[model samples]
Target chain A: MDERAALDLVGGLVGRAGDDAAVVDGTVVTTDMLHESTDFPAGTTRYTAGWRAVGASLSDVAAMGAEATAAVAVYGAPAFDAADLEAFLSGARDVCERVDAEYVGGDLDGHDEFTVASTALGETDDPVTRAGATADDVVCVTGGLGRSAAALRAFDAGDVDRANDLFQFTPRVAAGRALAPYATAMMDSSDGLARSLHQLAAASDCTIDVDEAAVPAVDAVADYATDDADAREMTVFFGEDFELVCTLPDDEIATARDACPVELTVVGDVTGDTAAASSDGAVTVGGDALPDRGFTHGD
Target chain B: MDERAALDLVGGLVGRAGDDAAVVDGTVVTTDMLHESTDFPAGTTRYTAGWRAVGASLSDVAAMGAEATAAVAVYGAPAFDAADLEAFLSGARDVCERVDAEYVGGDLDGHDEFTVASTALGETDDPVTRAGATADDVVCVTGGLGRSAAALRAFDAGDVDRANDLFQFTPRVAAGRALAPYATAMMDSSDGLARSLHQLAAASDCTIDVDEAAVPAVDAVADYATDDADAREMTVFFGEDFELVCTLPDDEIATARDACPVELTVVGDVTGDTAAASSDGAVTVGGDALPDRGFTHGD
Candidate 1:
């Protein structure tokens, strides 16, 4: 079975399958893994690896509108330099502090290649899962998308500095907290906008239609867009934006957006229909089918 | 820096560095990593891999005397057969079931080698840690030791079945829970009995001396022990036993042991001394130094 199939098998026990984190007895728990070979490109540094790995899991905490409490990492590598390990741990500690969480110590072991598995523990009084949206709910996203996609492109093109800069994303914790009280459904848009919409649709049992031109396109991806390609596709199809996608009742959108510390853009609305399926259900623009596009590990 | 040194660097934030799991707001969190190359022997089955990975982390929960609630795994491996993945998940699920914990969903990614990183979340009203032993406490252990060490020897000799049987250990969750209220300090003997004693002494600032003959030794290791080799060293040096080594008050030893489901062995006592250092503090029969012995990855 593939990853998704494995998830489906365990979905009955964990509850919401595609949600960023699982809530168990008031605790929001999430884990992420990063293999140096596939996750870190040639230009990546150990410091960045530690920071990005911890931050990615922390982003899941944000998606659940939880305050991160503590994090632990299990690091596996053949051998590490004393300085590199220290710097890597420093990066993890710094990132946890950035999200106002404690960095707990974890296990270390030897492996042929460098691999890090990080878990973030969080707590939330009123978590917002991706299962409450209804018809006419306004769908909004925090910040812009396609930054990481653009960064990957830049890295491939040897613009290492720009790529690194673009990959250093803030986890939108404050915005998620602000929207938690108002949002009906919420998730992190790390797996691309289109995929997020599909997941939200499936969870909330509603159809999410995006006005393609309405998506706030970041400038980094604009230079990479061709005439035949829609610049929004970069934002919708490629991921790692770490932005929060939330659906709020129309009456609550104004207050949620106003209370949010970051830029919140309303880009779509939910409709009740059997339109969440791929066969003629979702559309990106006029008569254009919205295909599922994004990243899935092991795919 | 070594693993312990790296933990000491982050010790300020998390408080106790070597505890089985970190407790935050009544929740217990711990993580463990397993790589196929070093962790798994040549003929290790995928089913055993998943069981051992999840079971290893759960053993930590047992060390803390916490009841496990949920577990998540981050599996990264080169393309695996569908049957292998299914068996792996089944193994994970079965292990969690054995401990009465939920097999919550986890992350899956593709990597060059098989790597499973598992984290277990647990809870307890009164958690037992490794820093509370007093000078007069009687040091005791749950279950016999040297099973894993002997298993390794068997594995080296092409006795895969015996190795697997010996390696499949029962985590002392029940025993730990029974001892939690009475024991002053506790930890898993996965790193070996001598190393565990040294750690307990270091954490509690006391000295522990073993009456060599009184220490329990499994027959599996006795067959492998040489004439000159001390029986206690066989149980102390090699690791991965998953037994609980605890310090209890002399007044409470009888009741604690009687209450424990696992067989209990009293091998030593706690004394006030600064001589617990590796050079000469610990001693066995005839004043022979019980040197530090156990596994350290990549050492």
Candidate 2:
């Protein structure tokens, strides 16, 4: 089974398992495991791998609208190279520091392939979940989409430095906390806009109708994609940008924008279209059906 | 570098890195990553693997004198068999239930080898650290030692049922919380009693003198080992028992005993003699030197 089906099985076993981060007693906790072959591309530095792996969990904390506190990683590889190990730690620490979180120590092990399992923790009295959205809520996202898609293009072109830079997008922790008070529902767009919108719709029991013209496409997409249509497809279907996708009432958008450090772009609106709702939820972009296609681990 | 040296490197990078579980705002969190080749022996079932992997993180929580609230694991394997996956989740959930903690959902991915990364979160107002032992405090252990060593022997003898049963040791969460208020220092002996004593001594800046005869070797050790000395060696040096080793004052032993559910076996005492202190904290057993030997991950 794919990641989504596996998650469904997990949800069946765990009572509180649907949220991006599991919040227990005001503490938000999440974990992400990345394998070298599956996650890191050719020429990707150990440092970049470390940063991206840990940042994935941090994004979950951000999705919960919690104050990022600390993170730990478990690194495994066939052999320990001093420089690579040091670089990995530096990357992990730097990313945590960027988001006002501490990079606590982690475990190390020997494995045939390089692997990283990162866990991030945060705190919040009020956590915004994907299940809280209403029909009238405006759908919005922080930063833009397709940054990771562009990074993949760069990696394909052997632009290692550019790819690494693209992989270093900041997790929207501050923006998440700022929008928590006003956001009806929130989650991270690590699985692409289309998939995330579908998830948000299903969780909130509503449909999300996207205005294609209003979707914020990162400039990097133009530099990497073959054409404008390709860029739009990349922005909607490719994931790993680590951006926050949230919903808010139309009246609260101005206040949320004022409080948020990053730009909040409105891309869609939650709708009361129960007739169109299916297992994948009714998600449309540019008046066209959006498929549930994105990064699926273990696929 | 080995696991200990790697830990030192990690300790140097993160200030609050030496504890078993990092305590932040009264919340304790710890993570453990285990690989199939390194951690699981032949004849091991996926269920046992899940139990032992998650149990390792719970042991860390128990060591910190906290109430475990929840746990999440990230599992990666070459392929996902329906039965294997279900069994793994069941094992993980059962272990959490045993400790009164929730088995929260986890992430899954495809990897070249089977791997599990588990994180456990706990809560506590007062956390017991490994650095609190004093000269006059008595060193004690909960549960017995050499259980895992015996399990390994069982596995070698093709006693899969007995091995799996032996591998399923209960994490001393309740006993740890009970001892927290009175114990001066506390840690789990996953790394075996000899190494644990050395670590406790070094962290507490004291020496530990052990009565070897008093060491509670599991009765199964006799069935596994060739002789009494072999059993004693296994009890002291072989690890993965998941028992708590603590330090308590002589006068408070009775109160601690009453509060604890498990047997509080007094095997040693902290000493003031600093002249003999080495890097391993001058640990001795039965008037002889006890080497810092135990299971070392990534060794």
Candidate 3:
């Protein structure tokens, strides 16, 4: 099968394959996505590279409303030296500890090219699944969207400082935990807000309608989007924001935000229909009678 | 640096920096080695392929004197179909249940070649470590060695049934647990009997000496050796024997054997000075002069 088909098949299997952490009784660990097709630039900040890996793995656990408890990292690094390897491990450990997780023992090997993989075990008493959203639930974001996208634009324009702040992001573990009890459906916005919402919508068997004006944008993104609507569009479509997006009952929105203490903005509401459309008629979650545009492996 | 130097440096750093799960005051989950460099055939045995992957991982926890609790598998398969992927997962889940470990979660991706990695966790009060051996300790093995090596040879020679029995081997978890308290030092012989003894000896700051005659050898391996000396040599040098070789106080040998109820053999004894040597007159263990002949990645 092609990459997309393989992803769908694997995703479906894992989704149905019980919980992520079976030993913890209430915990579940799911393999959200794994593709060897994304391009990570060489000479990128090593710290950021390490953070990217940890964040990627942790985000999956967070998406399930589970707090990461431990992680096992397996990487295939060719000709890597002691210092580089140490830095990589340190980075992973730092992230794990920051998120209140342990960096467990792992395997290492030499490969022709660099390949990093991790299995994160998480624990939770109540798991907020993507299939639990209901009509009239408020779709909320844990933090600002499109900043990472804007950072990428700045990076492409050689704005290193601006890009570093945005690209080197952390997962919203604390925010996810705070919202887990109240949120009906939860997921991390890795494949941009639009695509993630589309997934949440599909999984919940409902539609999501986002208010363009309500979707929070960073100041830097607004600056970058000045006179470039396409760039803004790309920011909404291509950005991996590394933030939690959850749908909760409209009544619980205030309480959830108060408990979370995060800058959560109500970007949309869940609908009974299976469509995901934007209010301004210029954007779509899954797309307007077309397919959603998100990060595709091997694209 | 050479592979040995690299390994030493990396291993030392990992040992120091990585959390000493074995040393920590908690249940330790360990798994055995599944090296593409040694263990399984390079081709064929699709069903056994996943088993080899999951089995190797689960074996570590099994050898740790702890019951298998949970596992996370990371694999790289090149252009594998959904069916193949499902079969692989099914095989992994089968082994997980066999070991009483839960298949918690994992990661998967495509690569230039097929690679399988797994991390298993288990719980026990305190883990058996390799640094507990002492001088005057009797060296013993839980099960027969050279079976895996024999299986490899048979598979290569198209002896399917014989190879299957040998290659698809089960670990001595019961024996490991039974001998945990009696064992002065313990480690699974993944990198051959000679090398594993050397590791245990070095870790425990003692010396190990194996009698060439007492070291067990499979019939096929014995026949392949052409003579007793050759058989002994193969038993010493050939790797991928996942048997538990432990050193215990001389007085506990009888009790350990009775408790384990396996084909326990007292191969040798630990000494204050270097004495372990192979049938070929080369010092294989204990002596500082012995050459490192165990498996090395990228060799």
List model 3 lDDT by residue over A1-299, tens digit each.
75556656555655344222232455444332232244344334545555567667787777777877766555556666767677767776777777887766455566656666666667777887777888889899977777766776777778776676566666778888888889998888776777777777777778776776677776777767756565557556775667888899999988998988569899887766555434423224343432466754434
- What are the Cα lDDT values of the candidates? 0.79, 0.88, 0.65
Error of 3 at A17 (Å): 3.3
Return the top candidate by TM-score: 2
Query: How many Å off is the CA of A65 in candidate 2?
Result: 1.2
Tens-digit lDDT string for candidate 1 (B1-299): 66556555546444545688888777888998888776888777777777788888888999998888888888777775667777777777888888888777677778787889999988898999888888788889988888887877788888898887777677777888889989999999888887788787777777777876777777888776665364555687777788999998999988998899989988888765555434567433334566666766656
Clashing pairs in 2: none
Model 1 C-alpha lDDT per residue in residues A1-299, reported as the tens digit of each score: 65556555556444445578988878888998887776778777677777888888998999998888888887777775666776677777788888888887787777778889999988998899988988889889999888877877788889888877677677777888889999999999877888888888878887777877777767888766664265666788877678999999999888887899999999888866445434656534444567766766766
How well is each residue in A1-299 modelled by candidate 2, as lDDT tens digits? 76688778777777878889988878889998998787899878988988898899999999999999999999898777777888899889889998999888778888889999999999999999998888888999998899999999999999999999898779899999999999999999988898888898888888888987788877888899998789877898888779999999999999999999998999998876556564544897655678878877788
- Candidate 2, A85: how far from true, in Å? 2.2
Candidates by lDDT, descending order: 2, 1, 3
TM-score of the candidate numbered 2?
A: 0.96
Q: Give the runs in model 1 whose Cα sits over 4 Å from its true position.
A: A9-17, A223-230, A275-278, B1-16, B154-162, B222-234, B275-279, B282-286
Q: Pairing residues by index, what is the TM-score of model 1?
A: 0.92
Across B194-260, the per-residue lDDT of candidate 3 in tens digits comes to 7776677666766666675678776779645557656655677676766777888999877888898
**What docking tier does model 3 reach?**
acceptable
* Sort by TM-score, top down from the best: 2, 1, 3
